[model samples]
Target: MKFSYLGDDAEEVSDVLTRCIGPVRVQKPLNTALSYRYEFIAAGRVAFSRATSQGSLSIGQKGEVPKLLVLLPLHGAARVRIGRDDSLISIPGKAAILDGNRLSELQIEEARSHLSFVIDQGEIFRHLSAALERPVHGSIDFTPELDLTTGAGEILFKLSQIMATCLGDNAEIQELPSTLSHLSEGIVNLLVDTVPHRFSAALTEGEWLPSPRHVKRAVDFMHANLSAPISMTDIAEAAGIGVRSLQEGFKRFKGASPISYLAQLRMEAAHRDLLNADQRLSVAEIARKWGFRHMGRFANDYRKSYGCPPSEARRRLPLSDA
Candidate 1:
């Protein structure tokens, strides 16, 4: 999940950049001696990268890019060209969002230091489809520019900085697979909610609050799939309603979102398993059985819900139950 490369050879730098970033054709490779230092970390369909190079690197691609890219320059600047005529310069305190299904060129200046995030376009669309409770056929139209010093863009920048710092520090939480998965989706969700995209209006528009029958349907579906990796789209499909409607219904009826309701169910299920499960099954095993993947988070939630930890909950149960 981590990659680092440092070299002076142009071809090797190109190869390393291609491997770390994406498929890129380096221009003027034979004439320059470059010192390129790059590090990359990836989780699921999302990736973070840092690059510092002593010499300029020009890269261009002929076909569509596979992942949506966000570039944040820390020092120096990069000239970016999307499609044919749309071009911009990415410097410090600014971020550039590049679409996945577009031809692009990048001009990295000497002594440039920047951090970039890459997210798979397919995964983005899949999450979008789930939020919409329907299939999405086309790519999102995102505003190419972001002022990273203020507003939601600044929050996103800070989040990326924090995540990169955590990953770089080899933090204990870096090993959390479920956390990583959630982080990826959460980042996409934030971008969708805050960024100026084609679907922003549709996503923000209010939906009709469903009746009690629909709310009951969603609750029943969630209870039936407590341990399953079901998404909002699945719950909406089961309830015969849109995701927005289902969300409003859950809020009106259960005072929570569908996901939160499902989490509550899963937590109760975990508590029940802890109380009655065989002593041989550890708290972790019981948690996993009820779809809790991150043990730390599971334990924390368990304590909050039961006024005690899972182990204590299990120990307090009557001997006959055990």
Candidate 2:
């Protein structure tokens, strides 16, 4: 889930960049020595990367970019053009949102370093559809420019920083698909709610509330299949309703999406197992028994919910069990 590349050969750098990012041509300044470094980490549907180099470079898109990409410069400015949009310059406190499926070009100056986030476009649309309680058909036209110094943008920037820092420091977290999925889902939800996009107005003007019966049914389904790989569609079918209706029912009555509710139930189940399991069961085993795939994430979530790690919970078992 992590990759690091350091080299002076522009051709080699180009090949690596193409593989990590989309199809692109990286050109070095004529007769100038180049020092290029790239570090990347991907978790679930979100990916973060850092690019640092000591020479000016011109990179041109050769094919479609399949994910929504955000570029924030740290040292030098970056000029970016996506599709036919006007070129925008990104500095330390500003960022550019590049449309997926669009050809683009980037110009980076010397001593350049920047952080980039690549989000799955399909995931974005899925979240948007759930929020609107309707099927979303096409791509969202997001404002290409984002100001990182104020308001929602600042919050987003901080969140990205925290995610990058935590994931970078604790490599084991990367292996937890569930944790990474939740993290990516948070980012998608934030973007759909706050970022200026074509669907912004529709999202704000919605007023579709499902019945309490539907919500109850969905909850029952989630409880019955707590250990199964269930989807929104499955929950909806079990509730005798549509997927969007299920989402609305949970939002209106439970104040949480169905998926979030399911996760909460699973977390509580994991907590109970941690407390009740015999000494033969390790914390990791209890976690896996309840569908938790990674110890690091399971411990973190357990601490948040019970004010202690799973190990601590096990150690506090009753004298009879001990």
lDDT of 1 by residue, 1-322 (tens): 7657777776676686666556677765467767877777777778777878888778786445446888888899889999889999989998899985677888876778888888766567667545654333345878998899998888878878866764465665568878767777778887877889876765666422233777778777877888889999999999999999989877754446888778877886787688678889999899998899999998887765444567776765231111
Q: In candidate 2, residue 218 scores what lDDT?
A: 80
User: How many residue pairs clash (N, CA or C atoms closer than 3 angstroms) in each of the candidate models, in the order given?
Assistant: 0, 0
In model 1, pairs of residues that clash are: none
Off by over 4 Å in 1: 166-171, 207-322
Q: Candidate 1: worst 10 consecutive residues by lDDT?
A: 313-322
What range of 10 consecutive residues in model 2 has the weakest lDDT sum?
A: 313-322
lDDT of 1 at 133: 46
TM-score, candidate number 2: 0.63
Q: After superposition, how far is residue 11 of candidate 1 from its true place, in Å?
A: 2.2
- Would you list the C-alpha lDDT of every candidate in the order shown? 0.74, 0.74
